[model samples]
Target chain A: MSALIDLFSVAAIGAGLFFFFAGTVGLLRFPDSLTRLHALSKADNLGLGLVVLGLIPRAENPLAALKLLVVWALVLLSGASTAQLIGRALRRGRK
Target chain B: MSVLPALDVGLALLVVGVAAWTIAARNLFASVVGYVAYGLLLALVWVRLYAPDVALTEAAVGGGVTGVLLVTAGKRLDALASAEVGVPPGRALKILAGALAALVAGALAWVVLTLPSPAPSLAPAAAEAAAGPGAGLGNPITAVLISYRSFDTMLEKVVLILAVLGVWSVGADAAWGAAPAPLRKVRPDGAMILLAQFLAPVGLLIGVHIFWVGADAPGGAFQGGALLAAMGMVAMMARLAEPPRIDSRKLRLALVAGPAVFLIVGVAGLALADNLFAYPQNFAKPLILFIEAFMVLSIAVALPMLVCGPPNGSPK
Candidate 1:
């Protein structure tokens, strides 16, 4: 059971890391503000979500697992909102 | 053999790189962003050193509140347009400043290196007291902050109140009793309003929980209160609430409540216990928590007020 859990955790975390790397590359290489933000918000959120999912199974207790989820949720909420706000500001500045 | 050392080295390098960027960044706003990132990275270093309490403090005040304060100041300066970019220092001045910085760093390094083989520490004494007379709090940091150093804690709250007063006293006489300028001049759109609505309550809950768990955990009143203040700022930014009038009775009351309650308790302690700040043996935990609750309230109000600065808006 532990071996199976570890395998799943490692696989999920690897996938998450790939997305994070992709997000960083996009953020650095994207030509425009909106596109960079698009790469960042979408890719990073999925990356963090996957990482959280991977870690939850290894949490010491149910509360710890729940706390991990809460962290991800809060990050997602803030990320999405800030991305929208930033995009709006960018549009306004161009105008 | 272990990757931990490499990770630590990398973290230290990252912190230094960010700090250097913060110093060297040409744009004021970019420097502030670098500063914020530097603070967060320093907080991570603190965590690696097994100092979660300090880490929380660094992350909240150093990164979060200070970032907001600086960004707000920068925005105001930009809006005023009177803030001319100052001329850069000449080569001689730059070299002199570098020499001075190097001298300070070298002196610090010398002092640290010349310390006795077994450096003095109060950890043993603190541990003894914390496990015995210091109210048996599970978290040694809390015990030190509240039980062992109650006077310092109370005075710290007083200092915050004093800071708020100091900020207020700078206002023009006409702006007295008025609110500070709104944090956001632009009307917040739907997304911001929704973020504030969804996040504030959850943040408040987490803040309280952080404070509540402080007796046995890494969280504390300052960290929790900082989070609460951040939430309040978010609400203000989203136009869900306005910064209160400086002279509002309720606002004044909240500002002073923490230190006032703490002082009153300390005075009462002289009668209840032998020392000025001592709690009775049986009631220490409850009293500490009670005092901390008020401290949290005061901190939450004081920080946001500090960021808002002296009142600038006309009286409502």
Candidate 2:
């Protein structure tokens, strides 16, 4: 049972690492600010969510797992809003 | 080659890399973003050092609140389209400054590497206070802040109040009592407003939970109050709420309440206990918690005021 859980954790965390790597590449390679923001928001948000989920089963307690979830949620909220705000500013600047 | 050690080595390298990027990034906004990343990375360093309380503060205040403050300043500067005004430094001066900075960094690194074994720390003293008569607080950081060194913490609160006043002093005489300009964007996006509306209540709850749990856990007044302040700034930015008026009595009261209560308790302690800041044996825990409650409120108010600065031309 423990071995199975460990394998699951590794797979989930590995997927998260992949998204993070993808996000960085997209950030550097994307042609424009809006597209870059899109890449970052999507990749980073899902990456963090998966990482948090993978760690939950390893948490010492249920509350600790929930706290991890809350951290991811807060980051998600902030990242989404930040990307939108920047996108709006970008369009306005060109106008 | 344990996983933990490898993670720590990678984190240290990442922190150094980001710190260098923060200083070297060509654009102001990029530099500020790098700084935010650096702050977050430093929080991880703090965690690795077995200082979760410090980690929370580093992440919330160092990274989160400071990031918002700088981004706001960057936006305002971008608006003015200000030309680069400073004289370009000659190569000789730049080299001298770089060499000096490198020397200082090397010295700091050497000190860390050669530190006395076992770290000659005050941990034992802090541990005694944590478990002893100093409020029976489980978290040593809170015990030291609220019980052992309450005076220093009280003074820190006063410093925050002074900062608020200093910002207020810079406003034009006619702008007193006026609301600061709205923090909204040129054309606020609908999605952000929805996010703020959903996030603010949840953030506020977590903020209070952090404050409440500080007595027993890694969270504390500073971390919780910063979260509260972050929520307020978000709501203001989303155009969901107006900034409080400068001359409002309630605003002034909340601003001073933390330090004021802390001071009152310290004065009362002289008569009620062995010395100033000493809570009578049975009442220690309750008194400390009472003071912390007010400190959180005051911190929540003071940080937003600092971020917002003083009142603008008219009430919004």
Which predicted model would earn the best TM-score? 1
lDDT by residue for model 2 over B1-316, one digit each (tens)? Answer: 9999999999999999999889888888899899999999999999999999999999998898899888877877777777244477899999999999999989999999999998789777867766665757777789888876778899999999998999888888889888666786454688778888999999899899999889888998989999999999888877888788888889999999999999999999999996887788888888898998899999999988887877889643
lDDT tens readout by residue for model 1, B40-129: 999999999999999999999999999999999898788887554667689999999999999999999999999997998877876765
Per-residue alpha-carbon lDDT of model 1 for A1-95, expressed as tens digits? Answer: 99999999999998999899999999999999999999999676999999998998999999999999999999999999999999998999999
| Model 2 C-alpha lDDT per residue in residues A1-95, reported as the tens digit of each score | 99999998999988888898899899999999998998899787999888887898899999899889888987888898788778888998999
Give me the overall lDDT of model 1.
0.90
Q: TM-score of each candidate?
A: 0.96, 0.89
Q: What is the TM-score of chain B alone in each candidate?
A: 0.94, 0.91
Residue ranges of candidate 2 with Cα displaced over 4 Å: B78-83, B89-121, B185-187, B314-316
lDDT of 1 at B8: 97
Superposition TM-score, candidate 1 onto the true structure? 0.96
Candidate 1 CAPRI category: high
